[model samples]
Target chain A: EIVEAIAGALGEGPLKGRRILVTSGPTHEPIDPVRYIANRSSGAQGTAIGAALAALGAEVIFVTGPADVPPPEGVQVVRVESAREMEAAVQAALPVDAGVFAAAVADWRVAQASDRKLKKTREGLPVFELAENPDILAGVSQMGEGRPGLVVGFAAETDDVIPHATAKRARKGCDWIVANDVSPATGIMGGTENAVVLITGEGAESWPRMGKADVARALAARIAAELETS
Target chain B: EIVEAIAGALGEGPLKGRRILVTSGPTHEPIDPVRYIANRSSGAQGTAIGAALAALGAEVIFVTGPADVPPPEGVQVVRVESAREMEAAVQAALPVDAGVFAAAVADWRVAQASDRKLKKTREGLPVFELAENPDILAGVSQMGEGRPGLVVGFAAETDDVIPHATAKRARKGCDWIVANDVSPATGIMGGTENAVVLITGEGAESWPRMGKADVARALAARIAAELETS
Candidate 1:
């Protein structure tokens, strides 16, 4: 019943001719076959956004890391595991009308991946060398050949969400940044609920707490409206 | 494992001495025994934020409407069914350190609820007379008795998300506004993911897309950090 209402709403203007690209989930920095460095992200947000965009009549290309949930129907899903692979996949799905960077890409990756699991040494803890992973959003926003009309990034901070998010937008050269706090207790990482702020070049907009699906639908509709005016 | 990690991170903070008031979910304005005016809100975001605040060691008072999900443990929860009830709950819970208006409250309610379901007319659909609901966030923000130090509101708009949110913040007399587009296609009404912008007097901060759980954690951490510095 609700799906029919949504379908009726989608039969309109704005995103009809646009192609959108989205990235979701946490990128793993492999340490060994049995171990890796990754955050507790489930990619629910990205999948919802992709579904929302598709419902708005836009073609969606979703690049995702390993996630516990499945991608929504009707989206072009490209599965990847590591930051490197995710970056490659995003790059391949270029020339999109808009790009939403929803993936919790690891800031750093293991310098070298070991194919086999390492046995625990009797001697204390082992140190793993880490290297900075390329900022996929920045790379795509600033260097992609088919530059998207609008590039959106996320700033997940434990403190100073707005200040850090503002700086990140400028540093990444993206058109907008969505800012949120991710201190462990929130349960927002794998939980079903969310609270968020939308930041752009002009200013910031805060949303009421609701379901992630509601947020995604609202965002897709806003994007479609913006595209129409642009 | 995640809960332990969060507890360790929030060992001590400004929120340690603070009290927070939060509202979540949708208000059901009943028209008849079997029908009511409500939205598709699950109160996930508000509950997550409440849990986040509690995790940070703040005394949290949560006033929620009808919700499918449970509130975070350890926080004082006040359940309500109508917008009027939510407003009363918030007012009673006031004099807190901060207030987050994350609930997706109905804007209107039936002026008078029928004790029994009204039979459908053989000729046409029934019409309902609705009255404007009190703006819970705005009212609480402007209250003089034990008003919170920081008042935050959320604006869910389909078009001109930022602009409309900015106006809402000013009109509501809140310290910050979280804004997002909640059009039909986004599936944000009852889903698990979200994308949003935070708008404040200083400006706006956009964030990338991530899980709602991460968003809640980050927001809790930010509030704690901000309270400490201020």
Candidate 2:
């Protein structure tokens, strides 16, 4: 353990001298004091990606929401619960060589979140006025300075994976977009295996179904190679 | 590990000959094919409760939703994603010695969930027609023939914890209600520690702030005693 720590401190591997930022899990946007809006993100893929990067000797900053899986070992973990918090955490861990936006951030938050728990009354249902959350991927990709050289975003789709992801790559202005089908038929959501298509400025490349850990390793290697070339 | 397994099979402890069903985590309600509505429940307390019950030699069937922490060891785990599925799972595990409903089930689901991803358009925001979900706790508690001897429900409240929980006990027809304040100021939501007020027909008892594991063990012990007497 001591030897490994010393080696890590010396920064000695394929991704040595490089800093990468990764986001994982589902953010919880407050609805009331006890209630929140969230999604079904286990953070398995993101945790694997962070671990893979670290294994390659990259200094990884893992900004995570409430995740089922624990953050990978040997990475700086910053926990946040809301999209706004995740954005702030990402901003704080800026100036990286690459950034991976893997979190399933909620798109909207209650416009007027109640400080107290809303009681169920005889009156009609409580109306939740929602406001759009900030676009972290677009924000980072369009940054004028201190932006990562490679900005990768994820799009979990049920259909038209390629077309939608291609359009998303252009819309979000990210260098790469990892798209996957998450329909109930796929059993991808909260499942161990993943089948993704990598969309980039060059074109779209479909990868066969693989374990999330394998995907992470391959993606990390690709990131290293891209950084070396750029 | 082998010896522990043998002991578990023998059921030679306080809760021997008992079957306990526990529900944990937050149920996800689909809005669109790629989008969902969920609550902020990590299932930490419920996971610990399952572990504690198992430790007391109770055969535990854990019905879980998408949870942050992994399901406890020494229990049968049944995974579900939505409130409807959870209710079905619970009903299937009926005729148990006790039932613990710890899941933060979504109160509402979209009336018509989209078959495909809802695209962002220039027209207007997509309105989600919401419908109330079935009351799982009430349904289980009102099961006259097959209802467990002891039925416990959880109420995550921000204010008026005691009052609300006391009322909830009657409304749900449950034997006990474990209530806690999840206000941001309280730091209980997604946190490891808990301070709960256990409400019963007898009265409400406030417990000191403690680790979730400790609370689970205490609650499990209480359940064992109640079952033994009943």
State the lDDT of candidate 2 residue by residue for B1-230, as single tens digits: 34433565678668988999999999888877656777778899999999888888899999999887899998999999889999899989988999999999888777898888776666745667777788899998998898899999999987888998999999989999999988778888889999999998999999999999989989998999999999
Per-residue accuracy of model 1 over A1-230 as CA lDDT, tens digit each:
26623662564345766889999987766655434555446789888888888877787899998765789887789999888999889888988999999998876666776644332344623455656677798898797577898888987766677887888888889988877766556666667877788888888888887788988888888788777777
TM-score of each: 0.49, 0.84
lDDT of 1 by residue, B1-230 (tens): 26643663464444676888988887767655434555446789889888778777788899998776888787889999889899889878868889999987776676777754343234534445656778888898788887777887987766677887888888889988877666546666567877788898898887676667777777778777767776
Model 1 chain B worst lDDT window (10 residues): B116-125
Considering only chain B, what TM-score does candidate 1 achieve? Answer: 0.92
CAPRI grade of model 1: incorrect
TM-score of 1: 0.49
